[model samples]
Target chain A: MKASARLVVGLDPHGNSVVRVLRSQSPLTLVPARRVGPVALVHLVSSVTSPLGGDSLELTVEVGPGASLDLRGVAATLMLPGPTGLPSSSVLRFSVEGSVRYVPEPTVVTSRAHHTAVVEAELDGHAELLLREVLVLGRVGESAGTLSTSVRATRCGKPLLHQQLVVGSPSIDSSAAGLAGKRVVGTSLMLDAVPRASDGGEWWNVVPLAAGGTLATALGDDVVTVTRVLDAI
Target chain B: MLTALILADSRFPGGGHVHSGGLEEAAARGLVTDEPSLKSFLHGRLLTTGLLAAGFAAAAARGEDLELLDAELDARTPSPAQREASRAQGRGMLRAARRAWPSERLAALSRDPHQPLVIGVLVGDPYEAALTCAYLAVSGPASAAVRLLGLDPFGVNAIVAALPVEDVASRAVKELPALGSPALDLLAEAHVRREGVRLFGS
Candidate 1:
């Protein structure tokens, strides 16, 4: 069970990026991966160096005041199998300070990989944030790996959104319960704002958004809006 | 079995009803209406927003330190209004737990207060707590869907049946994100200000 992980730090808007890579013969630890700045990007990469097994990794993101950070990925993440043929896992902790927003793209898990990822965020007054996550089961014909996810959002030390998901033996077409029997899964949430228009029907409305590539839905005011695409994969 | 049934019940007094789980806003915006549309909307939410919160609850159930859980939830939840809403529901549930469970752990957690914290104290098994949290979160909106859209009760149940609860619970334990969307946070904050809103909380 040999593994390697790299933490890359970047501050967008400033157009500066610094990345740190760490490798472990066993599991990867998050203590070394730290980001500092009003706006910074902490990127991480973990790989099972030894083919005979798999390993687990943990990462944390700490955000300071009035900072705007957008964490994007170079590619979809691939989770390898362990020596026992189970998927490896990762945990993410986001520590937020005054008025900073952290947005990261969704995560994709390759086939036959069994992994779980948890994300927790703590916020303060006058602070803001945005989060987006996506998970893919398998590659082509091979068994799409299983992925489990959980997310928590808080303000002034309280809980906002706590969510979890587990997808096992994912297939291209699943039933309503199984990705609604769809292939790709995505969701977006906007916290406390009133909707500009309620004419659509309930407080929430869905817009086609760009003919086909994007599908957007407006929920509540704007504080809590969700946009998702199963076909987006 | 009893724990499963009690926790799974919509009327468990968990204060879950107060939250539309973003459904109120989604429906108000007309993203969801009637049964099928509500099902689709909820399915999307369960995978995304709902998944995130459920994960926190599951982690809390796993007995991660309370202060650590508190810090994590703060970072994940970006909206001020949403934060109030979660704490409101958590506080409400804690009050209810005192009357229902009344265990020392529940009592201690209630003193400080948070939904996941209270749940962690009450539930002995991490998996069971995850299931309970997911059940409460998902079903709250399902019930709201019926009233908001006047959907058929049977169809609502059908949709509920289609939702992957176990999957949601397990996933909640794994793969949840820690990013906040400003666009949505702003909306939720505004939603909380509305005085005549029909929902329980913001």
Candidate 2:
């Protein structure tokens, strides 16, 4: 399956954020809330079983000046293998002039599944973005297949943070320098001017980026433990 | 080749010895208590951070813009501790290289550039620079393992020798790698917050 979804949010004269353009494709549904407010709430629903091997998905989100968008996911996505044995891929691009919060639910990389996910965000001056991602290796008693996920965020054409994480390869996954044998990995990227003190634990930490922003990362045996650390940040 | 060898040498006084590359913390946590565990840690480090550094080194050696590479590397390295470690080593290497192999490119580097960029400017060959970077990435941690865990030196040397450093270097030269080592980053941060006796800087 191949799908492309687009959503654009802009501010009105009354200072209320409104969704100007919303185009949804199968498995990439965007449902906006009925409430009127300064911030627009949109729920991303996967209307169909998606992201199987050989599937390609793309989502583009743009926020105009002074607008705010709260985009969220409804449920966990399962990366299942298709019969073709090919790899699946998804690209999420965000262009922000105001603010955006993209909080997607956890994604599970099941056995035999191979997927590549990339998220690229461009923010101008005074723009803010918060992105959260939680990845589970596999279902109970099952080992993960393979996943290569990357995130690159830039502000005013200068890079803020860019990272690529690859999972699978039992050796690397179990290594102390890699995932440290953890089953769940989570990260929250906050690209705002908020100054946060450096804090961490045995398997989690929140650190300031060199250019600007803060990244909170946690690894654990279960989703709840990992998410708890990220939530604390 | 000689430049690469000298920069990779432990006695070069680049201050690379002060950083364990997260091995100290791993050993303190009992995550790498034995030879096998040390091998796993080194392997993971090689594939992720090692690959990323080697790519930047290769790019630098290919005569890429120093300012742009520095900023790009900073973007790639999210952890401030890790970034500090690299720049600290880079400053050390730069101070020494100024007298040994001073060049316009070396002067072009920022006040505190990345260690890989220093190695690249000194080596002047992409493959050799990447090879030097990838090897150093595991060699430091390997020696740190021997010191921190009291592992057999011969066994650790064997492990490091058997690692696929050449393969990683070759792959690094193809493109700039953005691989991120989450566990290593956590270990580095935890090491900074350990609030006790510490042997290595990072």
Candidate 3:
């Protein structure tokens, strides 16, 4: 009983929200039970019924400017071994609208669970975007499972941020120089917000922001500088 | 031997200790704050921006024309902040390499330097050369993060363990996708105008 789910979110002529879901080879899948609203949340679950071995759950969302959207999964996906006994994989595609804020929590990849995702966004001139994507080595205390994840953030047909991560060893500990030496790692990048430079001949300096834990460094004469933030520390 | 080490060291006095590859501005806006967020940021940068830049540097090391490589890098970088950062670091790296290993190739390239141009003249192996430079690019920011985050020594190792080096050699290329983040350039411009700042030139 394996299944594949496809959910599409779009903006209407008036800029209202519209959501659609196509499950398997069935007819047009529409959520009459749940109509689209200002803030839309859509979840499509694919089960262990496919010939490909493991199940897949994909989430797609479209957030308009001045609106919000959160698309979550039904449960933490477990990639069971295929008929050949190898781990299974899934693909997640996310397309964001202009002026919308999209934040998807850390996706937990159990031992041997391989997932690949492509996130593309086209933001308007005045839009603001704050997003965080995390792939854990394994289940927290237990430390079992492997996760491979890829992310791409784009604007106006160009790419902003793209990354691929694979974690085969959950329990094994290595140096921070490798991944800042943390079990949990996150990245926060902002565009169009150039930091102000200091006087003197030097072009860059690290300064503490309003928050005690946060640090801001303005480098060079460009309009943007992304600060590295480690959530675990 | 010492030439290789100097080019790879994070503390090479090349003024690379500044700039966070868009991390500083991202953090200021609350895009990234803690360990989890920082890791995510690094991962994305390495795969997209880091991957693309390494590829070009590798080509340069392999004897690609210095002018051609510099032009390639210039065209690939879309944002002003990133452009400035690349040139600033390139100039600094060229200056340092000239002093550390003063050879005909290094001296000639240093006259008008760019990141890939200097790297092509100094690095021995195309593959390893790119990896070493890429490592410095990632390591410099990560080290800066240590100072910015006030991270514990033990925790620092944890971060290092997270970077994947196995496939970096093959991934280094001159024409990877462009990782264009306009906000990063915006921040760099603003930083330059501000007075009494502490970081190096972008």
Global lDDT for candidate 3? 0.49
TM-score of each: 0.51, 0.99, 0.52
lDDT of 3 by residue, A123-144 (tens): 5544445454444445555443
Model 2, residue B189: C-alpha shift (Å): 0.8
TM-score, cand. 3 vs. native: 0.52
Measured by TM-score, the strongest candidate is 2
Residue lDDT tens for model 1, A1-233:
43434343333455433333333233343233255554444333333231222455555555455454455443445565665885566666666553333334344456666777777767666555555555444554455567677666666655656545566633212322234333444554333222322112222222211101112223221111323331121
Question: Alpha carbon lDDT of residue B136, candidate 2?
Answer: 93
lDDT of each: 0.54, 0.95, 0.49
Q: Write the residue-wise lDDT of candidate 3 on B68-159 in tens digits.
A: 55654554453444666777778888777766777776655635455655765677676777676666656665666666676564665576
A167-215: candidate 2 lDDT, tens digit per residue: 9889999999999999999999999999999998888999999888999
TM-score-better candidate, 2 vs 3: 2
- lDDT for A91 (candidate 2): 98
Best by lDDT: 2
DockQ of each: 0.08, 0.94, 0.09
Lowest summed lDDT across 10 adjacent residues in model 2 chain B is found at B142-151
If both were scored by DockQ, which would come out higher, candidate 2 or candidate 3? Answer: 2
Badly placed stretches (over 4 Å) of model 3 are: A1-5, A13-15, A20-36, A45-69, A79-83, A97-106, A120-134, A170-173, A179-182, A185-233, B1-53, B59-88, B95-125, B131-202
Chain A superposition TM-score, candidate 2: 0.99
TM-score of chain B of each: 0.85, 0.99, 0.83
